[model samples]
Target: MIEVGSLTRRYGTTVAVDGLSFDVRPGTVTGILGTDGSGKSTTTRLILGLDGPDAGHVRINSRPIWRALLAAVRGRGAVRSPLLPPRSQRPTPSGALAAGGGMDPSRVGEVLGTVGIAGVARRRAGAFSLGMAQQLGIAGVLLRDPGVLLLDEPVNGLDPEGVRWISNLMRSPVARAP
Candidate 1:
């Protein structure tokens, strides 16, 4: 579970988040939406412990998140900005998963296949199209078999078929398993 209590953040005179509070239970899909610059990203940052909250707290699974590193480790899955490594440092999807650590080597092919990009599992990520890259990111998330998934603009570059694929995947019983 994710719990946010009276969270607040300010940038100089501007308020990015104000007294935000919510509870996200396990096996559910939650989305934060708003106009541009309406504190959506700021709230996500605060929840992830990427930035400090001025007046509230964030907890995951009943434990307060005290540091950025702990927050990163605690999350089952997340897709933040700049979805992949920079173009210059791109690696094959298999290699990328290897770099993330604690992942089973055999699962690389399995996850790639799950995301419908198995044929390109060995291709350099830098050369993949935007949709393929999004698939790669989703594959990474699925590799963890996470009970929680925080995806921002998950369908940003997908084709119709790809979009449908992801939708079905997210709604699958496996995705909601704890």
Candidate 2:
């Protein structure tokens, strides 16, 4: 369970989020959707505790989002957007995922396999298209298997098959559990 009350954020004169309130109940997938400049990302950041709200409150599963946000959000990239290294870097998806310490090869493999990109585990990320890049980003988040998921435009550039994979995952019991 995630809840927000009067969540508000301002930058100079711009109000990124304003008096927003909502609840994300288990057994369902909620989305913060809007047009450009609608503060969708800002709201997500605030919920994940990556950014502070000027005049509001947030809670997840009956607790404040203080300690569990990292595991919840996975990183800024998952809920904000992906930061892909240049193709010339020739980074493999699996290697790229395992670059940081603590994550083992099997975890990387499981995530890639779930996203249906296991075949490209050894392929250079630089060789991937926009859709594939989106999948990789999704795989990155799925690797954490967080209790709460906060994805942004997760299906933006995916092909039909990829879209189905993500939709299924998001609609699965994991995303809908109480």
Q: Quote the RMSD, in angstroms, for model 2.
A: 3.0
The clash count of every prediction, one per candidate, is 0, 1
Write the residue-wise lDDT of candidate 1 on 1-178 in tens digits.
8899999999999999999999988877677888888898888887766789999998887788774346547456777643677899998888888678677778888888888999987888898888888888888877877667777777778899988987887787756776
Error of 1 at 100 (Å): 3.7
Cα distance off (Å), candidate 2, residue 177 = 5.9
Instruction: Assess each prediction's global lDDT (C-alpha) against the native.
Output: 0.80, 0.77
In candidate 2, where is summed lDDT lowest over 10 consecutive residues? 71-80
The digit string of per-residue lDDT tens for model 2 on 77-148 reads 354565577767758989988885357999899888877889999988887877788878777766666556
Error of 1 at 1 (Å): 0.7
Candidate 1 accuracy as TM-score? 0.83
Candidate 2 to truth, TM = 0.81
Clashes of 2: 1
